[model samples]
Target chain A: MGLEHRAKWRINIYAWLLLLPSLIFLVLFTFYPVLQTVILSFYQADLGSPEPFFNGGDNYRIMLEDDVFWKVLTNNLWFALGTVPTSIALGLAMALFANKALRGKGFVRTAYFYPTVVPMIAVANIWLFIYTPEYGALSHVMEWFGHGGMNWLGDRTNVMFAMIFMVIWKEAGYFMIFYLAGLQNISKELYESASMDGAKPWTVFRRVTFPLLMPTTMFVLIIAFTNSFKLVDHLVIMTKGGPDNASNLLLYYIYETAFSFWDQGMASALTVVMVVILLLVAAIQFFGLDKKIHYN
Target chain B: MRTVVKGLFSVLMSMALITGCSSGNAPATGSQAGAGAGSEAAAGSGAGKASGEKTELTFFYPVAVGGPLTKIVDGMAEEFNKANPDIAVKPVYTGSYQDTTTKIQAAVQGKTPPDVAVMLSTELYTMLDMDAILPLDDFIAKDGGSEYVNDFYPGFMANSQVDGKTYSIPFQRSTIVLYYNKEAFKEVGLDPEKPPQNWDELVEYATKLKKDGRWGVEIPTSGFPYWMFQSFALQNGKNLMTEDGKKVFFDTPENVEALQLWVDLAKKHQVMPEGVIEWATVPSDFLEGKTAMMYHTTGNLTNVKNNAKFDFGVAFLPAKKTFGSPTGGGNFYMFKGIDEKKQEAAWKFIRFMTEPERAAQWSIDTGYVATRKSAYETESMKEYVKTFPVAAVARDQLAYGHAELSTHNNGKVTKALNDSLQAVITGQAEPAAALKKAQEEADKILAPFNK
Candidate 1:
C-alpha cells in the first residue's frame, strides 16, 4: 500500500516536471506582459521617463476626449461588421456550390482557396498600385470605362470601404475551407432520408444543412470577428490612418500612440480596452458555440 | 510506456537545457568596463592573451525610410571591424526617430541599455532630462582636443549642449534651404539668381512661376511644420517657444503672420496645389519639374543632385523680419549605464566621425552641411556644396536657429499644426480661426508639462 502511494506521488511529480517549461513560458511571455501592461496603463511614460510615474488613470481619461481614439474605434467596428458577415456568407455560398457535383470541382476548390496564402501586406502593396490616383491599373480601367480617375485609398469617404473590400476578397477563400469541412462532416444519409420524404432541395437544406453547419459557422464567425479586430496590417503600410485619420483602425492607433507619440501609457490603455472587447466577443461566441456543437 | 518515458525525459532535459542557455544569454554585466569576472568572460576571446580582450557593444540607431542607413552603417562597421580587429560595433536599426526613442527607453528600463545610440537632436533633451547621456567634456579633455573641439562653430554647437554640459555630438547636420528648378526659373523668365526675399516678393514671383501642372511653391504641412514655422519666425523676428522651454508661443502675431503666408500660398493665392499635405515627393516633383520651388533640409540636396535632370541651385529660405533657419539634424548619445571603457570607445567613434576632414568628407558624401567652422574651408566641402548667394544668406540666418522644441508630446503638437494647416488649406477655417483652434489644441497638450 505504501509502495502504491509512493508511485502515485511520483506520477504527480512527473506531471508537474513535464509542465514546468510550458509554465515558465506562460509566465515569461504572456502573464508577465499582461501584468506589465496593467501597470503601464496607469502612468505617463515617454523617452524622458524610462520607467513611468503613476499618473492615476489620466491616460484613460485623455483617451475619452481623444477624437483620434474615437475615430479609430469606430473604424475598427466598421471594419469588423463590414468584413465578417460578407466573408462568412460568401464562404458559405462558395462551399455549398463546391460541395455539389459540379464541373471542374477540384480546380474550383483550389481557386477559391488561393487568396488565403497571399499575405495581407503583400496584397495591400498590389492594391496600393492598383488604386493609385494617377498611374493605377484601376484608374486606367476607369478611363477605359469613360469615367475619370478616383482616389480609392486617398478619399476619406472611400478608404474604409476600399479596405473592407480587400479584406473580404482575402478572407472568403480561407473561411470557405472550414465550411467545406463542416459540409463533408454532415451526415449524408440524412439528406437522402429527407429526399425520400419528398422534401424540396431548399427545404432539405434549410432543415438539415443549416442545423448541422451551426458549429462551423460559429467557429468561423468567432475567428473572422477576432481577426478583423486584430488585423489592420494593411493600414500601417497603405494608408497609415491618413487622408486625415479616415481609415484608421484600433490596433494601428495603439501602435501609433505607443511608438509615434512615445506614450506607452495610452497605448497600454488602448490595448486593455481592445483585450476587453475581444474577451466579450469571444465569450459570446463560446457561449453560443456550446448551444449547437455536439460531440460524436 | 518506454516511449512515453523517453518523451518525458526529453522534455525535462530540454527545459533544463533551454533555461540554462537563456539565462546565460541575458544582458551581459560589467563587460563594458572590463572590471569584473563576468565582464571579462563576456569580452569573450581571451583574457590569457597578451593584449586586451575584444568587447561587444550595441548601437541603437534609427532605420531610415525603407532603411538604407542601416546597410550603410553595417558596411561601415564591417570595414571598421576589419581595420581594428579588436573592437566590434553592432548597429541595430530600430525603425524611425519616434520608434528609436521608445526602444531606447525600453532598453534603459530593462537595465540593458545600448552602449551607443543615434538620437534625433530635438529629443536629446528628453534623455538629458533623465541624465541618460554622459557629458563629453571629460572625453574631449582626455583626448587633448580642447582646441580642436572649439574649431566647430559656436552657433552649431549650441544645439548639442544644455546647461554647460555637451550631451550629444552632431552626427549629421542640415539646415533648411530653398531648392529651385532652374528650368522653371528660366521658363518664368525670372532670374534664378535673385530669388524672392520676403513674403510679398515670394507671392508675386510664385504667381508668375505658376502654370499648368506646376505649383509655384510647395510646403509639406503634415509631417513636421516646425521647419516651415522656423523659416517664417526667423524672418519675422520671433521664436516658437520661450528659451527655458516651458511654454509654446504659437498663435502669436509673428506665427500668425507666418502661417498666414502659408495659407495665402495655398488657399488665397492658390500658388501651392490643394490637398497636398506631405511634401514626401516634393523633391521628386521638383526633379520631375512639377513644382517650381521647395524649402527643405540640406540633407535632401544629395537626392536632388542624384536625380535632377536639369540644373538646380541651393539658396537660403526666404526670410520675413529676420533670417531664421532651424537646424535639422541628429546626434549620437551614449545611453545610460554604458560603462567607462565602452563610453570611451563611443567617444572615439564620435570624435573620428566629427574630425573636420572626416566631417567634410561625410558631409559631401551624404549632402550634410559642415557644422564645424574648420570644415567650411575644406576643398571637398566647398566644391560639393554648390555655391550660391542664397547659401551665404542661409548661413547668416543660422544665428536665429531655435532647435525643434518637441518633447515626447511632439506628436500632439504635430497633429495640431497638421490639423490647422489642413483646415486653412481645405477652407474649413480661415487663417485666424484655424490658427486659434490650433493654439487651443496645442495649449491643451502643453498644459500638462506647464503644470
Candidate 2:
C-alpha cells in the first residue's frame, strides 16, 4: 500500500512537470492579461503609466453612457446571431452532402473548403473589388438585369449584411470540415439499420444521426460563438466600422479605443464586458447544454 | 488534459507569431532593417572611438500614399549615414500615419521610444500630452535659429507649432487639390484647361460632366473624412479649430452650411455618387473613368501620373469664401528622454533631409509639396516644375492653407468630427444636427485639456 502511494506521488510529480510549460504560458499570456484588464478597467490609465490613477469604475460608467458603445455591443450581438447559426447550418448541409459517394467528389470537396485556406484580409480585398460601385462584378450582374445595385459597403442599411455575407462565405467551409469529421465518425451500421427499418432519409437523420451528432454540434456552437466575438479583421479592411458606426462590432471598437484613441482604461472596461459575455456563453455550453448532449 | 492545454497554447503562440511576421514584412520597409543596422553600429562604435562613437538614431516613418516611398526613405537614410559617419541613422517604414503614431505611442509607454519619427503634423498635441517629444525651440536656436525656421512656408509652419514653440519640422507635406480628367472636361464641352474655380462653377461643371452612368466628382469620405471636410469648412470662411488648440467651431453656421453643401453634392445635386467615397480607391475609380474629378491629397500626384492614361489637370479646390486647403502630412519630431547629444544628431539629420537640394529631390521623387520655399527655387525643383506645371498648383495653394484641425485629445476630437461628417454624408443625419452633436462631443473631450 505504501509503495503504491509512493508511485502515485511520483506520477503526480511527473504530471506537474509536464504541465509546467503550459501552466506558465497560460498564466503569463492569458490569465494575467485578463486579470490586468479587470484591474485596468477600474483605473484612469493611458498606456505606459507606471501606476494608473484609480478612477472607481469611471470607465464602466463612461461606457454605459456612451451611445456608440451600446451600438457596437448590439452590433456584435447581431453579428453573432446573424453569422453563427447560418454558418453552422450551411456547414452541416455541406458536410451531409459531401459525405455521400459521388463522382468528382474530391474536386467538390476542395471547392467547398477553398475559402478556409485564404486569409481574411485577402478575402475582404476580393470582396471589396466585387462590391466596388460601378464596374464591380455585382454591378455588372445588376446592369444586365436592368437595375443598378446599391453600394454594398457604403450605405448603412447594406454594409452589415454585406460584411455578414462575406464572413459566412469564408467561415462556413471551416465549420464544414469539423462537421464532416463528425459525420465520418458515425457508424455505418446505424444508417443501414435505419434503412432496414424503412425510415426515410430525413427522419433517420433527425432521430438517429442528429442525436448522435449532438456532441459535435455543441462543440461547433462554442467555436462559432467565440469566433464571432474575435473576428474583426474583415471590418478593419472592408468597412472600418463606418457609415456612422452602423456596422461597428465590440472587438473592433475596443481596438480603436485602445490603439487609436489611446484610452487603455476604457478599452479594458470594454474587454471585461466582452470576457463576461464570453464566460456566460461558456457557462451555458459546459453546464446547461452539455447536459443534453450524449457522449459515446 | 495537459496535452490539450499545451496544444492550445502552442496554436495561439503560432498564430500570433504568424500575424506578427506577416504584418511587419508585407509593408515595404520593415523596422528590422533598423534593428539590423543598430547592431552593426554597435560593432563599429568601439573601433571608431578616435573620432567619436556614432549616435545610433532610429527614425520611423509612415507612407500614407502609394509609391515606392519606403525605398526612397531607406535610400535617403543610407546617404545620410554615409555622409555623416558620426551619426548612424536607421530608417524604419511603418505602415501608415495612423500606424506610425500608434507604434510610437506604444513604444513611448514601453520606454524604448525611437530617437526620431515622422508622424502626422496634427499628432503634435497627442505627442505633447504623452510627453513623448522634445520641443524644437532650443534645437532651432542652436542650429541657425529662426532664419532656418522662417525658410519653411508659414502654412506648413502653422501645423508644426504649439503655444508659440516649435516642436516639429515639416518634411513630407501636402494639400488637397482637385484632380480632373481633361478628357472628361473636353467631352463635356467645358474648357479642358480651365477647371472649376468656385462652388457654383464646380456644381455647374459637375452637372455638365455627368453622363452615361459615371458620376462627375468624388470627395472621399471614408479614411479621412474630417480632412476633406476641413477643405469645405475653410472655403466657407470658417476654420474648424482655433489656433490655440483650445476651442473648435464645428457647429458654426458657416461650417454647417459647408457640410450641407457636401451632403447636397450626393443627395440634392446628384453630381457625386450617392454614398461615401473611399479614399484609397478614389484614384483607381478616376483612372477607370468612373469619375471626372476627385478631391485628394497632392501626395497622390505621382500615383495618378503613373496610372492615368489621359491628360489630367491639378487645380486648387473650388472656392467659396476663398480657395483654401489645410496643409497635411508628416513632420519630423525628436522624442524626449534622449540625451542632448542624440537630440543634436537627430536635428542634424532633419536639417540634412530638409536641405534645398534634398528637399527638391524628395519633392520630385514623391509628389509632396516642397516644405521650404527655397526648395522650389532650387534648379532641380524649377526644372521639374517646368516639365510638369501641374505640380505647381499644390505649391501655390499654400497661400490659402491653414493648419489642419488639431486640439488636445486630437484623436477623439477628430473622430467626433469624422463620425459626424460620415453621418451627414451617408444621409443618416442632417448637416446642422450632426455638426451640433459633433461639437458637443468635441467640447466634452476638449474640456479637460482646457481646464
Candidate 3:
C-alpha cells in the first residue's frame, strides 16, 4: 500500500509539472489583467499622477451619467442584434446551397470563405471608398436608378446600419464554413429517411437538418455576439466614433478613454462592465442554451 | 485507458510548448536591448578611440497623414547624423499624433521614455502634468539665453510657453488656409485672383459657385472638428480658452454666433454639405472638383499641388471681426529622466534640424510652415515662395494666427467641444444648446485642474 501511494504521488507531481507553463501564462496574461482591471476600476488613475487615487464607485457613477457611454453600449447591443442572426441565417443558407450537388461547388466554397482570409483594416479601407458620397459604388448604382445617394457613413441614422451591413458581408462567409462542416457531419441517410416519410422539402429541412445544426448555430451565435463587442478596428478606420457617437462601441469607447483621453480608471470601469456582460452572456449561452442544443 | 492517457499527455505538452514559446520571447528582446547597449559603446569607441563616445538619442515622431512623410523624416535624420558626428539620432515614426502620445505616455509610465518626441503643441498641459518633459528654458539659458528662443515665430511660440517657462520647441507648425479652384472660380464668374475676405463675401461667393453637381465650399467636420471650429470662433472675435489654459468660454455669445454661421453655411446658405464632412475625403473632394473651395491645413498644399489637374490658389481664411487662425502642428519636447548628455544631444539635433536653411527646405518639401521668421528670409524659401507665390499665404497669415486650443485635460475638453460641434453640424442639436452642453462637460473635466 505504501509503495502504491508513493507511485501515485510521483505521477501527480509529473502531471502538474507538465502543466506549469500553461498555468503561468494563464495567471500572467489572463487572470492578472482581469484582477487588475477590477481593482483599477475602483480608483481614479490618471496616467500623469504618481499613484491612483482611491475613489470607490465614482468611475461607475461617471459611466452611468455619461450619455456617450450609454449610447455606445446600446449601439453595441443593437449591432450584435443586427449582425448575429442575419449572418448566421445567411451562413446556413450558403451552407445548404454549397452542400447540395451543384456544379462548381468547389469554387463556390472558396468564394464563401475568401473574406475570412482578408484583414479587417483592408476591408474597412475598401468599404470606406466604396461608401463615398455620389462617387462610390453604391452611389453610382443609385444614380443609375435616377435616385439621390445618401451619405452612408456621415449620417447618424444610416451609419450603424451601414456598418452592420459591412460586418455581415464580412462575417457571413466565415460562419458558413462551420455550418458546412456541420452539414457534412449529418449523414445523407437522414435526408433519405425524411423523404421516405412523405415529407416535403421544407418539412424535411425543418424536422431533420435544423435540429442537427443547432450545435453549430449555437457556436456561431456566440462568436458573432463576441465579435460585435470586440471588432472596433473598422470603426477606427471608417468613423472614429463620429457623427455624435452614433456608431461607437463599448470597446472603442474604452480605447478612446484609456489611450486617447489617458483616463485609465474610467476605461477600466468600462472594461469591467464589458467583461461582466460578456460573462453573463457566455454563462447563459453555455448553460441555458447548451441543454437545447442536440448532442450526438 | 493507456492511449487516452498518452493523448492527454501529448496535448498538455503541446500547450506547454506554445505558452513557453510566447512568454520566452519577451525576455530575449530585453536581453537584446542589453546587447545593443554594449555594441553601441563599442561602436562609439571604435569611431575615434580618442575623443569621448557619441551620444545616441531616440526620437519619437508621428506622421498624421499618409504620404512621403516617413521617408522625408528618415532623410532628415540621416542628414543630421551626417552633419553632427558626435550625436547619433534615431527617428522612429510612430503612427498619428494620438498614437505617438499614447506611446510616449506609456513609455513614461513604464520609466523608459524616449529622449525626445514630437508631440502636439496642445499636449503642453498634459506633458506638464505627467512631469515627463524637461523645460527648454534651462537649456536655452545655458546656451546663452533668449536670443535663440526668440527667433521662432511668436505665434508659434504662444503654445510653447506656460507659466513663464518654455517646455516645447516649434516644428512642423501650420495654420488654416483657403484653397480655391481657380478654374471653378472663373467658371462661376468670380475673379480668379480674388478670394472671399469676409463672411458675407464667403456666402455670396459660395452662392454664386453653387450648382448641380458641385458644392461651393466644404469644411470637414469629422476629424479635428474643434480645430476647424476654432478658426470660426476666433474669426468671430472669441478665443476658446484663456492664455493660462484653465477656463474655457464655450457658451459665449460670440462662439454661438460662430457656430451658427457654420451651420447656416449648410442649412441657411445651402452651399455646402448638410451632414458631417469627412477630413480624409475632403482633400480628394477638393482636388476632384467636388467642392470649389475648402478650408484645410496648409500642410496639404503639396498634396493638392501634386494631384490637382487645374489651376488653384491658396489664400487666408476669410475673417469676420478680424482675420485670425489657430497655429497647429507638432513641437519638439525632450523627456525628463534622460541624462544631460542625451539632453544636450537632443538639443543639438533640434538646432541642426531647425536651422534656417533646413527649416526652409522642410517647408518647401512638406508644405508645413517654416517655424522661424528667419526661415522665410532664407534664400531657398524666398525663391520657392516667389516661384509658387501661394506657398507664402500660410507664412503671411502668421500675423493673424494665435495658439491652438489647449487647456488642462485638453483631449477630453477638446472632445467635448468636438462632440458638440459635430452635433450641431449634423443638425442633431442647435448651436447655442450644443455649446452650452459642451461648456458644462468642459467645466466638469476641468474642475480638478482648477482645484
Candidate 4:
C-alpha cells in the first residue's frame, strides 16, 4: 500500500509540474485580471478623481441609463443576428461544395480561405478604401449598377449593414474550415448506405450530413457569437463608431470608455456585463444544446 | 489522501515559482516601450558616469499631419544629440494625437513617462487635472522671461497658459483655412484669383461649383467635428469655451445659427454631401478634384501641394460675422517628476527645437504655421513665402484665430458636441434640440470642475 501510494504521489507531482507553466499564465493573465475587473466594477475611478473610491453599484446603474451603452448593445445583437446563422450556413454550403469531387478543389478551398489569413486591422484598412465615397472601389461598382453615390459608411442607416457584410465576408471562410473538418469526420459508410437506398442529394444532406454536423455547428455558433462581441479593431480603422454611433459595438464602447474617457470603473462594469453575457451564451450552447446534439 | 496532499504541496511550490518568474519578468516588460527605453537610458547614464556625465532623454511626439514628419523629428533629435553631446534625445513616434495621449496616460500610470512630449495644446486642462506635466514658467523665466514667451504667436499661446503660468510651448500649430481648386473655380465661371470672402458668397460659389460628379465643398465632420464647428461658432461671433476652461457656450443662439448653416450647405443648398464627411478623406477628395473647396487644417498645405494635379489656392475661411478659425496642434511639454538635470536638458532641447531658424525650416518642410512670430522674419521663410505665396495664408489668419474648444473632461465634453453636430449634419436630429442636449451634457461634465 505504501509503494502504491508513493507511485500515485509521484504521478500527481508530475501532473502538477507539467501544468504549472500554462497554469501560471492563465492565472496571471486571465483569472487575476478578471477578478480585478470585477472588483474595479464596484469602485469609482476616473481620471478626474484623485483616488479610486468604492461606489457600490453606481457604475452598473449608470450603464443601465447610458444611451450609448444601450445603442451599442442593441447594435451588437443585431450584428450577431445578421452574421451568425448566415455565415454558418454559407460556411456549410462552401464546405459541401469543396467536399465534392470537383476539378481544382485545392484552388477553390484556398480561394475560400484567403480572407481568413489577413489580419483584421489590415482588412479594415483595405475595406476603408473600398467603401470610401466618390472614388472608392465600391462606389465605382455602384456606379456601374446605376446606384452611384451610395455612402456605405457615412449614412447611419447603411453603416451597420456595411459592417455586417464585411464581417461575414471575413468570417464565413474561417467557419468553412471547421465544417469541412466535421464533414470529413462522418463515416463514409453512412453516405454510401444512404446513396444505395436511393436517397437524393438534397434529401441525403438534410437527413444525414447536417445532423452529423451538429457538434461543429454548435461550436461554431458559440465562436461566432463571442466573436461578434470581441471584434472592434475594424471600428478603430473604419467608421470609428461614427454617424452618431450607428455601427458601434459593445467591445468598442468599452474601449472608448476605458482608454479614451479614462472611466476605469465604468469600463470595468461594462466588461463585467460583457463577460456575464458571453458566459450565459456559452452555457446555453454547451448545456441546453448539447443534449440535443447527435454525437457520432 | 496522501496523493492529494502531495498534489496540494506541489501546487504551492508551483505558485511560488510563478510569482518568482513574474516578479523577475515584470521590470523587463512592465511598461512596454517606455520601460525598455528607461532601462536603456539608465544603462547609458551609468556608462557615461565613468566619462563625462550624460543625460539621456526620451521625447515622445505624435504626427497628426501627413508627411515624413517622423524622419524630420528623428533627424532633429540626432542633430540635437550631436550639438549637445552631453545630452541625448531619443524621439519616439507614438502615433496620432489620441494614441499619444493614451500612451502617455499609460506610461504616467506606470511611473515611466518620457522626459518630454509634444501633445495636443487642448490637453492642457486634462494634463493639469492628472498632474502629469510641468509648468514651464521657470524655464521661460530663466531663458528670457516675457521675451521668450511673447515670441510665440498669441493665438497659439492661448491654449498654452493658465492663470499666468505657462505649461507648454507651441510647436506644430495650425488654423482652419479654405483650400480651393483654382481650376474648378475657373471652370465654374468664378474668378480663380477670388475665393469666397463671406458666408453669402460661399453659398453662391458652392452652388455654382456643384456638378454631378463633384461636390462644391466638404468640411470634415467625423473625426474632429467640434474643431470644425468651433470655426463656425467663432465666425458667427462666439467662441465655444471660456478662457478659464470651466464653461462652454455650445448652445448659444449664434452657435445654433452656425450649425443650421452647416446643415443647410448640404440639405437646402445641395452643395455638400448630406452625411458625415470623413476628416482624412476630405483632403483626398479635394486632391481628386471631386470637391471644389474644402475646410481643412493649414497643416495639410504641404500634402495638398504635393498631391494636387491642378492649381490650388489657400485662403481664410469665408466669414459669417468675421473671418475666424481656432488654432490647433501640439505643443512641447516637459513631464513632471524628472530630475533637475533631465529637466534642464529637456528645456534646452525644447529651445533648440523652437529657435527661429529651425521653426522656419520646419514650416517650410511640413506646412505647419511657425509658432514663433520671428520665424517668419527668417530669410528662408521669406524666400519660401515669395515662391509659394499661399504658404503664409495660415499665418496671416492668426489675427482672427482663437483657442480650440478645451475644457475639463475634454474628451467626453468634446464627444458630446461632436455627436450633436454629427446628428444634425446626418439629419437625424434638429440643430436646436441637439445643441441644447449637448450643452446640458457639457454642463454636467463641467459642474464638478466649476466647484
TM per candidate:
0.79, 0.92, 0.91, 0.92
Model 2: CA > 4 A from native: A1-7, A47-51, B1-52
For each prediction in turn, the share of the native Cα contacts (below 8 Å between chains A and B) that it retains comes to: 0.12, 0.33, 0.36, 0.34
Lowest-sum lDDT 10-residue window in model 4 chain B: B1-10
Write model 4 residue lDDT over B1-451, tens digit each, in one string: 0121122223333444555555533432223345676766875786776578678999999998777899999999999999999998989999999889877876665556789999999999988988888888888888868998898888999999898889999999989999999999999789999999999999999999999989999999886699999998999998999888999999899998889999999989999988988887889899999999999999889889888999999999999899999999999999876766688899999999999999999999989999988999999999999999998899999989899899888888988898888889888999999999999999988898888
Q: Score the docking of each candidate (DockQ).
A: 0.19, 0.33, 0.32, 0.41
lDDT of 4 by residue, A1-296 (tens): 69999999999999999999999978865676677778889998886686889999999998998899999999999999999999889999999998894899999999999988998989998998888988999999999988778878888988899999999999999999999999989999998999899999999999999999999999999999988888788988888888888888888887778766778789889888888999999998999999989998
lDDT (Cα, tens digit) per residue for candidate 2, span A1-296: 69999999999999999999999988877886677678878998753343569999899999999999999998988899999999999988988888784887787678889998898888889998888888788889888786564677888878888888888888898888898898888889988999999999899989888888899899999989988888887777777888788888888888788767778788889888888998999999999998898676
Tens-digit lDDT track for model 3 on B87-169? 88999999989889977886775556789999999999988888788888867887737877888988899999988999899
Q: Considering every candidate listed, which one attains the maximal DockQ?
A: 4
Model 3 quality (TM-score): 0.91
Tens-place lDDT digits, model 1, residues B1-451: 0121122223324434555555554543324334566665644444466365666678777744321556666776666667666677787878777678866765654456789887887765456545566777778787836686677655456667765667777767677878888778888899977878777888998998988667798876434556676668767876666544445666777777777788778767978855534445566667767678888777777688778898887776776776567776677787666665677777766666677776776666666667676776777666654553333434555566556655436666666766565556555567677777777887876676665
Badly placed stretches (over 4 Å) of model 4 are A1-11, B1-51
Please, what's the RMSD in Å of model 2? 6.2
Candidate 1 DockQ category?
incorrect
Kindly provide the TM-score of model 1 when superposed on the true structure, using C-alpha atoms.
0.79
lDDT of 3 by residue, A1-296 (tens): 69999999999999999999999988765666677678888999874455789999999998999999999999999999999999999989998998884899999999988887788989988899888886778878878778554678888988999999999999999999999999989888888887788899998889889998999999998888888888888888898898889888988888888777878788889888888998888999999999988875
> Please, what is the whole-model Cα lDDT of each candidate in the order they appear?
0.71, 0.84, 0.85, 0.87
Prediction 3 global C-alpha lDDT: 0.85
Candidate 1 C-alpha lDDT tens digits along A59-117: 89999988889988898899999999999999999999988847999999899998888
Q: Candidate 4, clashing residue pairs?
A: none
